[model samples]
Target: MRIALFNDYRIGSVNGSRVADITEVVDTRWHGTPYVINEFIAHWDQINPSISAAMDRADTHELAGVRLLPPVPRPGQILAAPANYRAHVSEMTGSRHRPANAQALLSPREVGFFVKSPGSVSGPSDAIELPPIPGRSFHHEVELGVVIGKPARGISRERAREHIFGYLVLLDMTMRTDGEHQEERTMRKSFETFTPIGPFLVTADEIADPTALRLRLWVNDELRQDADTADLIVGVDELIERASAVVTLQPGDIYATGTPDGVGPVEAGDTVRAGIDGLGEMSIPVTERGW
Candidate 1:
C-alpha cells in the first residue's frame, strides 16, 4: 500500500490522484502530536482495522494541497552507505580512488556508514538550501531509502527483508570537501536541507525484489544517473545484516542504500528529481542561502 504524510502531519493512503484522509482514522486515537509515518505502521493493526484491510480507500476529506515531508519526521537515525554500487564505485575509482583499493583505503570493507543529521531532512516539494560556504562543491547522490519496520539486532542477510517496513527515494545532497576535516565525508553531508526523501512510502510487500528496481536522477530535466539496484556491490540484505551487527535497527531507522553513477552539482534555482520504479519520486528546488 502507498502511504504518505501530508500537510500538517496528516496521514493519507494514496489512490491515483486521490488521497484518503487516514488522518481522521489515525488522529481519532492519537491526537495533537505530530504523527510520523512510523506511528501509523506501529498502530494501524490495533487502532484501525479498516486501514489494515484496504490498501486503496476513497478520499474521505478534502485533500490538503501542501508539501510532503520525509515520512519519518524524526527518524531515530539516518545511516547511509557510500560507494555500495559497482557503477558508482567505478566512477569514483580513477579520481577518488580505485574500487579495488577503496575497500582498504576508504574503509568500504569495514561496512562504512555515514550519519546524516536528521534536521537535514526535507520533503518532495521543499527547497534545498545552498549554504554559501566558499570553496565548496556540492553533489547529489540519488539513493534508495530503506525504512525499518521493527526493532532488530544482528539480523541475518537471509532474513533482512522480514525487518523492512517500506522504501522511499532519497537524494543524499552533499557538500563535497567542506574542509571541516579532510578525512571525513560527513562534513559536507550534514548541512541543513541536504537530504530530500519521499513522495510516499511503498510497503515491502509491494516490492518483491528490492535489488531489481531501476534508480535514476535528473538534474534540471537532464538525466544524469541511470542505474539499477542490481548494480549494488553489497545489496540491501547484506547492508541490513551488516549494519545490524553494529547497532540495533529500530522501527523508524532509515538506511539510504547508496547512489549509482552520475554524481554532479546544482546551484540555486535548480530542480533535482530522483526515483525508483514501483516506489515513488521526489522533486526539490534549490535555493541559495546567505551566511
Candidate 2:
C-alpha cells in the first residue's frame, strides 16, 4: 500500500488516481508532535488490517486535490549517507566546489553517517527556499529515503529488511559553503526546506528488491542524475545495520541512502523533479527565501 499524509496530517491509503481517507480509523493519540507516524509504523501489523477495512468504506479524494506531505513527517532521526555512490565520491572529490579544507571523501562504510535536522523536511509541493546567506550555492542530492518500522539495535544486515517500513523519494538540498568562515558539514545540509520528501511512501512489501530500483532527477527540463541502486557502495540493509549499532533505529526514523553523481547548483525559478521506481516521484519549485 502507498501510505500518505495529506493536508493537516490526515492519513490516507493511496489507490490509482485516488486516496481512501483512513485518518478516521487511525488512533487519535498519534495526531500531533514528536513521532506521530511512529505508532502507525510500529503497529502496522495491527493497523494494516484496519486500514484496509476502512478504505473499503471510507470517502475517496482525487489524488490531485489534496496537498501531499512528507510520508514520515517529523521523523526521529534523519540519517544521511554521504558519498555512498562511488561515482558521487569521485564527482565531489574532483569538483571545483569541493571544500578546500575538507577531508578526503570516501564511501559511507568508512565515513559513517551524518544527520539532517528533522526540521528540514517539507512536503513534495512546497518550495525549496534558499537562505539569505550570500555567496553560497545550493546543490540538490536526490536520494532514496528509507523509513524504519521496528526498533532495532546492533541487528545484522540480514535482519534489516524486517525493520523497514517503506521508501520514498527525497531531495537532500545542500548549501555549498565558501570563504574563510566555513559552514560545518551537518549545518550545510540541515537548513530548513533542505529536505523535500514524498508523493507517497511505498511500503516495503510492494518492492521485492530495493537495490534493483533506479533513481533519476531533473532540473527544469534537463536530466541531471540518473543511476541504478545496484551501484551503491553501501547498500540499504548494511546501512541500517551499521547505523543501528550507533543509535537504536526507531519506527519512523529515516535514512537517506545518499545520491548518485550529477549533483549541481540550483537557483531561484528552477524546478526540481525526482523519481524512484515504485516509490513514485515529486516536483518542487526553487525560490529565494521570502523572509
Candidate 3:
C-alpha cells in the first residue's frame, strides 16, 4: 500500500485521483495513535487490518488537491550514511587514497554517518531555505530512504530485509565547512530544512526488489544525478544490518542510504526534483532564510 500524510495532517490512504478518509477509523478507536504516518509505522500490524478494511469501505471524496508531507514528519531520528556510494566516496577522498586512511580523513567512522535533526525534514515540493552562514558550501545528495518496521539490533546483512518497512526518496542537503582542527572533519552538515524526504511511503511489499530501482535527481529541470540503486557499493540489506550492529533500528527510524554522484549546489528560487522509478517524485523550491 502507498501510505501518505495529507490535508492538514489527516490520516488517509491514497487511491487513484482520490484520497480516502480513514481519519474516522483512527478516530473511532485509535485516536491515541494519531496520523497514519505515525501509527501505520510504529504499529504496522495493529492497524494494517483496519486500514485494509477501511480501504474496502471508503466513501469517495473529491481529491483535496492537498500537498504531501515527508512520510514521517517527526521520525524519532534520521540516520544518514555518508559516501556509501563507491564513486561518491572516491570523489570526497581522492581515488588514490586507501580505505583505512579514507575513514580517518572523513572522521565519523569507516562508514561516516551523521544525524540530521528531525526538525530539518520537509516534504518533497516544500521550500528549502538557505541559512545565513557565509562561505559554507551547500550541496544536494539524493538518496534512498529506508524506513524501519520492526525493532532490531545486531542484525545480519542476510537478515536485514526482514526488518524493513518501506522506502522513500530523500535529499540529504549538506552544508560544507572545514572543521576546527587541521586534520579534523566535523562539518555541520545536518542543518534545518536540510532533509527532504517523501511524497509518499512505498511499502516494501509493493516493491519486488529495492536494488533494481532507478534513482535520479534534477535541478531547475536539468538532470544532475542519474544512476541506479544497483550501482550502490553496499546494498540496502547490508546497510540495515551494519547500522543495526551499532544502534537499535526502531520503527519510524530512517536511514538515508547515501546519494549517487553529480553532487551540486542550488541557489534561491531553484526547483529541485528527485525520484525513484517505483516510488514517487518530489519537487522543492529553494529560498533564502536568515540565520
Cα error of candidate 1 at position 275, Å: 1.4
Provide the lDDT at 134 for model 1: 75
Candidate 2 contains a number of clashing pairs equal to: 0
Candidate 1 lDDT tens digits, 1-291: 787777778777776766776665554545434555667766545645777444355454433465566677778789989778776766666544222333332323465677888788888867888988776767888989999987779999999988898998888988755333343567568787888888888889899899999988998999999999898877898888888988999887899998888998898888998889998877788899765
Q: Which stretches of candidate 3 lie over 4 Å from their true place?
A: 25-36, 59-64, 94-109, 178-187
The C-alpha stretches of model 1 lying farther than 4 A from their native spots are 25-32, 44-48, 52-64, 96-109, 178-183
TM-score of each: 0.88, 0.96, 0.87
Better of 1 and 2 by TM-score: 2
Candidate 2 backbone collisions, by pair: none
Candidates sorted by lDDT, descending order? 2, 1, 3
TM-score for candidate 2: 0.96
Ranked by TM-score, the better of candidates 2 and 3 is 2
Worst 10 residues of 3 by lDDT: 178-187
Taking every candidate in turn, the Cα RMSD to the unseen true structure, in Å, is 3.3, 1.4, 3.8
Clash count list over all predictions: 0, 0, 0
Best model per TM-score: 2
What TM-score would candidate 3 get against the native? 0.87
Q: Report the lDDT of model 3 for residue 44.
A: 70
